[model samples]
Target: MSEIIRRDPRREWIARNRLHPDHASVLAALGVNRGGAAVSEWLGPHGVVRKNPHAIGFIGPNDVKRIDRSGFQQGGQSAATTPVAQDSRRTVTIDQPAFLVAVVPDLTGGRLSAHDKDLLGLARRVADADADQPGAVVAILFGEHKGEGDGELKEQALGDAGIDRVVHLNDEFYAGFAPEARLAALSAVEREMMPRFWLLPDSPLGGADLGRRLALRLGERAATGVWQVEADNEASLGWRCTARGGAGSLDIQRPLPRVALALAECAEPVDETRHAAEQLTLAASIPTTLSRIEDLGQVAVDPAGVALAEAEFILSGGNGVKEWGAFHHAAKVLGATEGASRVAVDDGFMARDRQVGATGTWVTARVYMAVGISGAIQHLQGIQRCDKVVAINLDPGCDIIKRADLAVIGDSTQILAALVTMVEQQRGGQRDAA
Candidate 1:
């Protein structure tokens, strides 16, 4: 990413599609009013922008200029910083020196006047960004409910990493799901779930729009597809968003809480066991609500539980790694877990959970092998912590290459065949020695 793009990649963004989940929802989450109703509910058989008066920005701070004035991680870039959300914002004291948003009542009806009063109030708080850890990593667990473990790993990973706090919303009041459809259905179940963040985990098309509506409704600045998780000496948090390398990366030092999406880079899930029942047991986070709509029947999900997180090494397909059966061979070779991507799932490669990205899983492990993925920003965001990353791509310029320690320019179909044999040979040798 050029330095210029890293700082200001949104020009192409502003000029493009509102249907984009990342950009649209992120800005929406940040308090920009895109102005409209849900596209799916509004658009007719033809695709067209529907202007709806309900379209509004999030609950800006009681002041506007102050927020714009106090900007970025260091609070300098005031050129354009948006508002945060009313998605049940919270301010808690966790013994760490950190800025606090004390949860004020957003009286603005979840709308912001472009550059208004409540906004400036938020800006004034920008200086409070770095309350404790200079480079603290903040993680939020969304789409949660009580009695079930939907946001389990998210909570565990952050905890295992020793991140300050794992925030969970009191309920799914602010879930990215079609709220109008099943508000009551989820509300009862989410009561026990602690959701530090309210998110829309819907499809990419609806995601951006959902975030936008959320920002407008909540009045916060929201950015989606966050690739980097770093803690600098700023307030709130600073995430390496996909916007990095394109537009300058975001330094959300603004008082407005930024809405961010973690890259679910089909990396391995972590296997940190939280001792329960005085015994070591496999820990899993599954959202279970007694009130699920029985009339609708079973919700499709990944029933197979594999030890991807436990693997010392993982070899799998990204958007690439085509030719169906090759996936099975790769997994069998290393006694590894197998999974696919959103594209892979769409093309009948694997189930949904097997798919990875901001909408999927985040993994940190020893070895990462990529075949066929173009290395889009979203795919590579969650993978920085890998001890070693090997990229195999036909396109040499894929973004994944920059992040990879080793690069292999080749086709994964053939590569997988060779790798399977190679891995088996090495494993066989290790076992023989043992």
Candidate 2:
């Protein structure tokens, strides 16, 4: 005869309600909230959980187990459940100083931003040179939630990129680009880690805004769009950046514990994948006053219309394009973000945000189509990272033509019109065939 089995009341209740029996019943039994401090306590000292008074729970070691679909054992001892040694626990203090800390904003699509990767590489180099002991490279990822699937991939990627520790502030408010919420979270981490140097990417929206705000709040000097950062001695750091539209370069020196904003394409990413970094989660209380600006929704744009620094393909214009409307149409047809030289912005043909040059936004597109741009030195600096440059200019001797991978000597208006027609006809043909 088969042995009789008794059903667990909590498990039965969870089943009747169509809930996950193991996960729900275990949490209910332990009186633990999904991502709350109670869960951390139940998991023991190895698990670090921050209490966010305003927002929901955060990403932590427990999240990794949950993502792996590995049910919790009654008395099973694993990394998630193992308690830290008393001696080791004493050494890991909240206020200990780290060599460098890189604040990485959670990017969309659960991938690390190119600029953030570069910042990490820079941090690794700085830490190696400037530290008294073997310094640590820490990365703080502020986002809404631990991404889907086993959160191992992201953690591993950061480790491979040379991050010794990753502090994730996973809250719904952090999921989107909430500057105020991120600032609060970062402030909390800063207080806890007390890092000597802070690195931030100089992206238009997130990094620059956060870096400036943090500097103002903390009363630290901030250097924006910095190309190089090096320790002047052990106490001061030096920053190098372009000044006056590539006409000159400025080098500024500031004391330690300063915030530095890294410019795009300043450093190459290092390829050193190591074991996954140690992970921590911070729970923070976002001020209601600060979070008054709620994000409504996002509007859809063509996939190619990404940020200038992040775009793979770009259609840029100069004064040579007679009609701005035709130029825009050509960009739309090519599925490219519209960019402009300084002269075009000066002529009011393009907005300041669309301008690409040394003084404006620096772009590293895979294919850059420059229509009628004469290509000044400043303009050339912006597209230096572009893989292929296609220039259409009436003058064969123009600076842009000389530098272009493929140069077409023609009228800008005629070339743009022809390209638009060609793209539209191709689309029409594909539709008919379909």
Show pairs that collide, candidate 2. 144-175, 160-273
Flag regions of model 1 displaced more than 4 Å. Answer: 1-304, 307-312, 428-434
Q: What is the lDDT of residue 423 in candidate 2?
A: 85
| Cα deviation of 144, candidate 1, in Å | 41
lDDT of each: 0.44, 0.68
**Judged by TM-score, which candidate is best?**
2
Query: Residue-wise lDDT of candidate 2 within 1-434, one digit each (tens)?
Result: 76864445554344234256476566566554443323332332334443322232233565532222133332222223323344321122122334545556435345566787787777766666644554577777766323333568656666666677778666677756577777777777787667767888877786878888888877886766677654454554542333122323655444434677777665677574352467865555534336777887777678444788878789999988898888888887888998999999998988898899899989988789999999999999999988779999999888998789999998989988988898899999999999
TM-score of each: 0.30, 0.46
**Candidate 2: misplaced stretches above 4 Å?**
1-100, 105-109, 130-132, 144-151, 234-257, 273-275, 283-290, 300-434
Candidate 1 per-residue lDDT over residues 11-101, each given as its tens digit: 3344235566575664454333343323221222233433433232223455432332333432222233234633342323245333322
